[model samples]
Target: MPQFALEPAVIEPMVEALGFELVDLRVAGSAARRVVRVRIDLPGGGRPGHGVTTDDCRRVSRELESRLEAAGAVATQWELEVSSPGIERPVRFASHWRRYVGREVRLKAVGVRGKARATIVAVPDDAHVALEMEGAVVTIALEAIQDATLVVDWSTYGKREAGES
Candidate 1:
């Protein structure tokens, strides 16, 4: 595996200092040009309407970009994109699963053919989760899950217009 220019260890603290959770981070490319994609979220896990805003991304981007440039961490000309985790943001860590209990999520497990939309009922332990799927509650090892993301129902947010579903 090729080493990335920016490591999580360095970026995590910088992001947290800005009072946001570092949801995800990825750096790609060579010494000449690099692509840094950062996903951020509120410490409280912002939901739908009350989520991280454009200003937040800009704040992070500016600070992070400046710091990296001053430190000469990567190429001087690097692309830094800071944005919020979308409505269907990934729920990969135990803390994330715990944070979203009672919320619906789409899960892709080891033997599942397709992604299953289910409510995260509980986090029994660090290694397992209890999800309510298809009217039945099932306990699944965390390792069995390949992917899990929040399921957002936009209609649940604000008032819908007349004749809307």
Candidate 2:
């Protein structure tokens, strides 16, 4: 069965109740090498730079594991991993675009191999984003985007953050 089948009944609600956003979930490998990787983010943020901590990951992991088992989402032995979306976090949903507006992003579209590095100006709607690429504002449909990841400028952000402290 597809992973989406369990979102409504298990994952989405559980993650929301924990005050976190579900970043990504991947179930890979075969029956013998099963792996379930889950990425989560704290909306209000906890750490200075990152929005989550080790404890948050552990807590979510424990809760999700129990829920998954109870829901019978996993029928066999599987390795579960839960972690925070790091500096280079993947933007998986339309909400993500609005959340990280003005941040540098790398977008990969279908039929296009190269990733476009640009700054997000606005999330015009759920299906499109306005980006400032090469000094020009361009709009791209979210559906055509295969993947979008935030590009962190650690040095710049760190320096700015330090000054504010």
Q: Candidates' lDDT values, in order?
A: 0.84, 0.79
Q: lDDT by residue for model 1 over 1-165, one digit each (tens)?
A: 233368767888999999999887777666667789999999978655788999999999999999877777764467999999987798877888999899999889987779899899999999999999999999999989987888777766534445545
TM-score, candidate 2, is 0.79
Name the regions of candidate 1 deviating beyond 4 angstroms.
5-9, 26-34, 68-78, 158-165
Per-model RMSD to reference: 4.7, 3.1
Clashing pairs in 1: none
Alpha carbon deviation, residue 4, candidate 1 (Å): 1.3
Off by over 4 Å in 2: 1-10, 31-33, 45-50, 159-165
Name the lDDT of candidate 2: 0.79
Best by TM-score: 2
